[model samples]
Target chain A: MSHPGADRVRDVARLAGRSARSKRRSFLAEGPQAVREALRRHRSGTPTVEQVFATDEALARHPELAEPTDGVTLRRVTADVLAAMSDTVTPQGVVAVCRMLDVGLDDVLAGSPRLIAVLCQVRDPGNAGTVLRAADSAGADAVILTHGSVDLYNPKAVRSTVGSLFHLPVVLGVPFADLAVRLREAGVAVLAADGHGDADLDALQDASAARRLAGSAPDDEGTGPRLEAPTAWLFGNEAHGLAEEELTAADARVRVPVYGAAESLNVGTAATVCLYASARAQRR
Target chain B: MSHPGADRVRDVARLAGRSARSKRRSFLAEGPQAVREALRRHRSGTPTVEQVFATDEALARHPELAEPTDGVTLRRVTADVLAAMSDTVTPQGVVAVCRMLDVGLDDVLAGSPRLIAVLCQVRDPGNAGTVLRAADSAGADAVILTHGSVDLYNPKAVRSTVGSLFHLPVVLGVPFADLAVRLREAGVAVLAADGHGDADLDALQDASAARRLAGSAPDDEGTGPRLEAPTAWLFGNEAHGLAEEELTAADARVRVPVYGAAESLNVGTAATVCLYASARAQRR
Candidate 1:
């Protein structure tokens, strides 16, 4: 059955994306686990969830949704309304909209971070999410998305993160020019992964033996050996790879060694390897 | 601009999936690279491609579609008709219905082989495709997908392979019961990846001593570092991972060591690491 405010529901759904354009709000907070995490970390110690739409089936499945809250708003919507609002194929039966958290560069880099991931022009939403999830697991401090990268709020991208989007701090919309300046200013060395590089990953790991790299760092760079500083890795687009301009801006160019048949690796897989390698180096 | 035979075109498009159920004739070929790869391989003596379809635009873009050959039926469809028949959001203007080639266990092991990948219950079409692509790049001799894995002819899976599916031999629908017997007969040992294993990946690689230990003969059944024969590396499902029964069946259970916070590597990333490690060992 159609609802009374079908147009309103559709409008809210569209608002998920256009919020950035229309209201200057660019992020979306979604999924049950994500919603819970968002609630747990509210500044007021009580998250003011702007809206809540739940189904009888969903509420029964997750009774926690029925819990009373002081500042949170509550409402009931048909499955169709929730479906219309959902970006994923199967809506997890819960979603929330809030102002995007503006995590400052200084705050994200407060300490001498051992690991950081810099994403350059990664176009696939799923790849972007997986990269973030990997970085979260590796205990990396932040993920930097440069120009031409897919938006992190793209629903498929958010779902792929499996709640990691909330756990970690992500900085997006930074141009390559700004990233080079900002990261360099923060003592972050940029290492871009290219297929043709002089140094092998194994030797590079040995070079950065003092730092305790964990979670994800930047992609490995340099001609001789491992990354030796507080590094930020640069990953490029799947098809075009790292642009020459971006590659030239990097402190080093590194590659994962391969043998025999394959010419290259998938962008996501390559990023994961480099991040994990840096983590291993730091641990040593 | 509706064509007279538009109904038939839509009917054919819908049948792509259902056709496999009845006729067991499923074909998923798209993009310029995929269609071109099919044409090149079929012309070079592989008898897989049964027919080719193109629009006038596609024919102009890829003149190779005009090549004459017996048993290769070339059909012309309108651009709209081609769009109706396409599975991708952006059709390459050319597609082909290729006969599925099931390279058998004996066929893949015909020569003294070095590297191979065996996927068990890997459900994601994209992950399966990447594994096949990685296998091809790593120069693996063959890729085998056990029952319960994603269908090899899935359109999403085919697209993710990026034409690498044509370069390497892939075998699907093999039951573990049959695979166990065939692997034993071929003098191949199976090593399954586990998250919580006794030793780390580096230790396992070091123990293999650069694959020099993977000599001509299989080790004694169920004893000491297990069989070092030409190996069959098994990858499990994305969520629950390898079942206890499946993990126990392997010649050895191995894990990729993690630092910091990642719960585990994404399924495709893990498969690539394990496959590349084995390939590296074989080379040594």
Candidate 2:
């Protein structure tokens, strides 16, 4: 489509937000990283892309973007069409419609599945994205988004992931009860990171050490049977942390202690700290 | 001052980026939190706020924002004026021109000055703001933004801070040479955090154990002069870490060990881990 008409453009713009995204059951992916990930997945015969739209200038800007791929058709559209489809400034000049990467619990738990981050009602797109990026970088098995979490495909959330979205399994819209039962059945230790956590993360480190001691021969620092069993570190919303029940359900409560007068750390920063703490301890 | 004309709006928008921010010696502070911080400081005899501009709707929406203050004056302008002035969606309906907080070395070291974060050339506004939030929460005495870092007052940077900008002194634009000399004079230990850091952060943690042990002897951390000291943790640009000279100038090099595919953590996340590690070690 060279250019959608005014009404169609309105529809495309609406697609950039939640309502249209839900209606279409697809979201727009823009930017070099996002588009490149989409194209690569399509070429690898994963999900066939619904549409590939690029401006002539985009094609010129990125000659490689014009490559041929089966089942993935490409078209040159007007800048207006590109603008209609974008929510970020400096659109990567290419856009694509992607069916959500909605993996099921079985698929998520099929692997060794050591580490996972379960985000609860994280409303900010930036925070949710950062958590996913942390999960991806930490080699977590997957990121499960429960009720009230921001939509992962929100353009801002996608931008914040910095392309890690493609590298990891991010399943959204899962409810708390379903996650609790699902992860429990898969032998995952669900831990919650809260300010009032029962134990500081230091204790978690100590617990990992104690587990190692119990599992291995006395001579080693004890590196056998990692204490975490397909772990899920649940982080709550920025303003209010995880609900009391969620905290109680955790195998343990972990906290990143603060020393300053500042009331609290940002949710994204805290989530990164907690994820890194667990990941580091597992390494030890 | 409703609708200061397209020319002025263009000028303000241009200044939101770096070159103009420097040339004009002013930066943008958008959203309720940042604007509220500016307003609070203005009321507290801080003399930093230069002007307050709000739309009629904003004034109506937030009447408490009109509390009379000595140093700052508030201006009620048309919706067009606030819309023209805002960089965020929905505007939070207020904008302020505040003098940058000019924190001198004397002011930074005025108190106990136990910990500090020195960021060099980190260009992302989100990263910079997150670091500020981390530093504030960790009870660090101050944050030093070396040359090439993002303008701390950029609207996005301010938003990321989530109001921590008001809690601590942030010194920006300081040359590296001056920072090194000043820190050395204050008997501070400068630690550089880089990908190639010589010692793992655990070593830094261990270094504090003796302080804590000796601290039990009374006279506050055993006259080792407040475990962390005038200690400054140096961080580098996102794309490029600390320069060879900057890293070498540090008293020690430390790294946060990672167990996953992430070659390195995000700069803000790394800085938070480092600062929090320092915070953990200094506690009683």
Best-performing candidate as measured by TM-score: 1
* Root-mean-square deviation of Cα positions for candidate 1 versus the true structure, in angstroms: 5.2
Query: lDDT tens string, model 2, A1-284?
Result: 45556775576567687888888887777876677777776777687366777888888878777898777768788876787767877786887777777687678887757788899999988888878877766667788898778889888887777667776777778877667767777877777878877667765554564555356543355432234445788899887789877877777776667777566767777877777666765654
Q: Which residue segments of model 2 deviate by more than 4 Å?
A: A1-28, A35-87, A93-99, A110-112, A196-198, A202-230, A239-255, B1-32, B35-87, B93-97, B109-112, B196-198, B202-230, B251-253
CA lDDT scores, all candidates in order:
0.70, 0.74
Docking class of 2: acceptable
True contacts kept of 2: 0.53
Pairing residues by index, what is the TM-score of model 1? 0.82
- Candidate 1: segments with Cα more than 4 A from true spot: A1-12, A20-26, A36-52, A63-77, A198-229, A257-263, B1-15, B18-26, B59-76, B202-229, B258-264
Q: Which candidate achieves the best DockQ against the true structure?
A: 2
Residue A240 alpha-carbon offset, candidate 2, angstroms: 4.6
